[model samples]
Target: MNDKHFDKIKNNDGFIAALDQSGGSTPKALAAYGVPETAYSNDDEMFKLVHDMRTRIITSPAFSSEKILGAILFEQTMDREIEGKYTGDYLADKGVVPFLKVDKGLAEKENGVQMMKPIHDLDETLRRANERHIFGTKMRSVIHEPNEEGIKAVVDQQFDIAKRIIEAGLVPIIEPEVDINSSDKEKCEDMLKEEILKHLNELSSDQLVMLKLTIPTKANLYKELIEHPNVVRVVALSGGYSRDEANEKLKENDGLIASFSRALASDLHADQSDAEFNQSLQKAVDSIHDASVNKK
Candidate 1:
């Protein structure tokens, strides 16, 4: 991304609604919407369900304005349009930036940690993102505990892809999600933070990176990260928290904002009334927004 595009993202500082659910995530969300598993016996059927959900989100009034600065879209939803216009164009028209998820999902454990599968054809993906007028990209890899070796592996691989993403002209949101259920949460956060600093300390003066981390047990645990020269913003994922629980925890952090998917769309389902769905979405957005900007 150019300086102007990067500035656009940095200047907003608003919550990002992560709607980038892949194949594995799509079924779970659809099941919650009352769609039976037997219905998705085929890929086409599953695609339709995902498409409908994304269309609902893009067209929702709650997502149309400035309250959401950006959204991370799945590959399938990347090409879909709203009102005969491209999805990215649709978002831009409504004053919301659009980002694409480029990772090929997670691979099996390596060194006791799950790593993000390498992008199969990242150059082409970046080309597609550029064609779609996307502003940035997000990729996820999980850190299960405070294993130093595992944390180092995750951090190294994340930044390795980040460099290519930056070279391709898209800002990268590096997500090394710490398992929220881990008992050693505090130690995990510290090691992860240190590993992050190791990468940031090596960045060129012109480089800027964003982080999407699990909210640490201690509020303001990422203060140094938020203030880092090469780090533009720090956002939090809900991980497995409920809507209310996520908002409560998010409020405790001074600088982190929400980039949540489940928390943002918690109670809304395909079966709900449009009014009901919108109400839930609005509630999620309002609570998250209020908590993120309301410093302790």
Candidate 2:
């Protein structure tokens, strides 16, 4: 969060509206919430996870359906992968935009060019984001054991995909996922900045509007975020992040969206019930809601 980007994004309201949160609310959270841990074990586990999450997404106070456009529609990503949850038309009816994540898994061929097909189902995804005015394509650049070539490839392919997604009309939420593979915090931050610059060089400034990252919670990380600008509206991931981290990211700015998943489902890691997951999500949701109110 460099000062330049922070101020840049903070200056734009439309950019803030571009945030799309499609993560968290797991079946594990459900079990811990009190639906009985058994609900998630048998043949019915997947079904229950889906059903409970959907119901809670619309009804729960934790979920700000009113403020946010539902995620891109899908079972896995509707929460994480951008499932939108609602059908494209349904989203339109509610006056809420849809967001799609375009990822073509990864390369499988041993000697093939390792290109990811984010816009794999191009025609359909284009129709969804464009015709529907879906917010944009929030890209994921995975840094899993990534060497220089791998990192560059991930950045290159994903950015190229971002270019296409924007040309198609949706905005781009460039997410360079930083995890264990990213090594240390300095490396993680540097790589992320590099990827953004690379992406900007190709996509230019006008076509992009979002920065979706799961920033780390270390104190230095906090200082690092303080230095960034809000070039794109910010949205922090739900899990793998701490409140301190989010506060640092959003304090320099506002109008950002944060996913309320893992943090909400903490106990669920131990494996709880549907009721438990709901409760976790509920708490997570409330935390965000409260933050929003405070921001007001």
Candidate 3:
């Protein structure tokens, strides 16, 4: 692990940029950026378009480590280049830590939850990420309702994978997102928290992990999780919230910082001039940064 990057993540007052939209979410992300499905004929073309979008965001003067401590990248993005440098190297050069999304998307819904599909050749992916200078990894599972058995399974699967990631020398961001639209969202959050604490307690003092969670329905519901000795940092996902709503909710939670994807790109369009693009991105970054570092 890069100690400097580790220290920055530990101490920086900034939010992480979630640029890790993979096969499942890429189309939505592209469409939001004003690129339609008709623009891409194949997966290669689609990925290229998204890569261009990400490159624009990464190279923008507004996207700096000063207010953006880290960036979570899709595996393809990590493999690609930004201005002739590998994405991870480019990010690190710009003083931003790089994290790779390691999940192979979620499995079919079962027991009111969607667990991550098996990550085939995960060790190989981790090897490549490490070679590319990735600082950490993020994997996600989803809780659709308050099913205690299912939530426990989700958390168990996450922690099990996290240990492997840690042994390979990369911090893991365990993301068990509770669907914001669920009727019992708050109950789901509560159940999820309990399961997470159980696993966190089992970790050795030296085992540090990060968490990327959906913003809870109740403000500061994760206060104990944030303060857990085994946790390095706790971050919030926008989870379909608009930028304004996410920021408002974020400010109500003191220690949780943002790791927003859709919300971060909500104002950007592919056709916008560089000046306009940078301005919009800057505004979003500034708002998220304030919400991250300043509590209400």
Candidate 4:
């Protein structure tokens, strides 16, 4: 990324929002939001529905405000048009940096954990990010517990891809999401921190990275990460927490900001009245924004 583009997003104090749902999840997410199952019975129909839903979010009142500094989009939605302009361009016009989800999805488990599957066409993906004017990218891998081998596997994969993304001149949000209800949550977090620091230590000062971890079980578990010189910012994922619960968890951390998906869009439903949808979305935005800004 160029200095001006990088600084534009890096300096943001507002939270990030994840709106990227892959093809497999598109039908389910629409169904959960009360879109009739019949409306998205096939891939073609489903893509349109997902694109429409993304449109709703981009055009939502909350999206125009400073509370949302950026959004991560699915490939299908990132380039679609909004009011005669591409989606990413539209977000930039509204002062929200656009990002893309570049991972293919999780791979089959190995060593009792599942790591993010590599993007086979990463060069093309990064080129697309640049062409679309996207500012960053995010990929997810899941850690079940504090297994040393498993953590190493996940971190190495994430860092490998992150190096590629940084080389492509876009930020990478490395997400090794620990299951929120894991019994060894605290230990798992410590393992992640150590591994992340080890990888970061090898990078020169010019290379930077971003993190999107699950809400730590213990308060300030990510403090060192937030303060690390090579880390641009640290944000937390809601995983499965409700809005109120996620907000509370975020409040306990000193520097982590929200980069929520489900928690950020928790109460919005397709069946709701327009006023109700707006009310719920604004509330979610305010709660997350408040938690992020209060840390500063």
Residue-pair clashes, model 3: 0
| Candidate 1: stretches off by over 4 Å | 2-5
CA-only RMSD, every prediction? 1.5, 7.5, 0.6, 1.5
Residue lDDT tens for model 4, 67-129 = 887888998777788888888889888888888999898888776568987689999989987
Task: Quote each prediction's TM-score.
Answer: 0.96, 0.61, 0.99, 0.96
Worst 10 residues of 3 by lDDT: 1-10
lDDT of each: 0.85, 0.48, 0.96, 0.85
Give one digit per residue, the lDDT tens place, for model 3 in 51-110. Answer: 999999999999998999999999999999999999999999999999999999999999
Query: Model 4 misses residue 271 by how many Å?
Result: 2.7
User: After TM-score superposition, what is the CA distance of residue 113 in candidate 2 from its true location, in Å?
Assistant: 15
lDDT of 3: 0.96
Best by lDDT: 3
For residues 248-293, write the lDDT of model 1, one tens digit per residue.
8988888788999988877777888999888877888888888777
- What's model 1's TM-score? 0.96
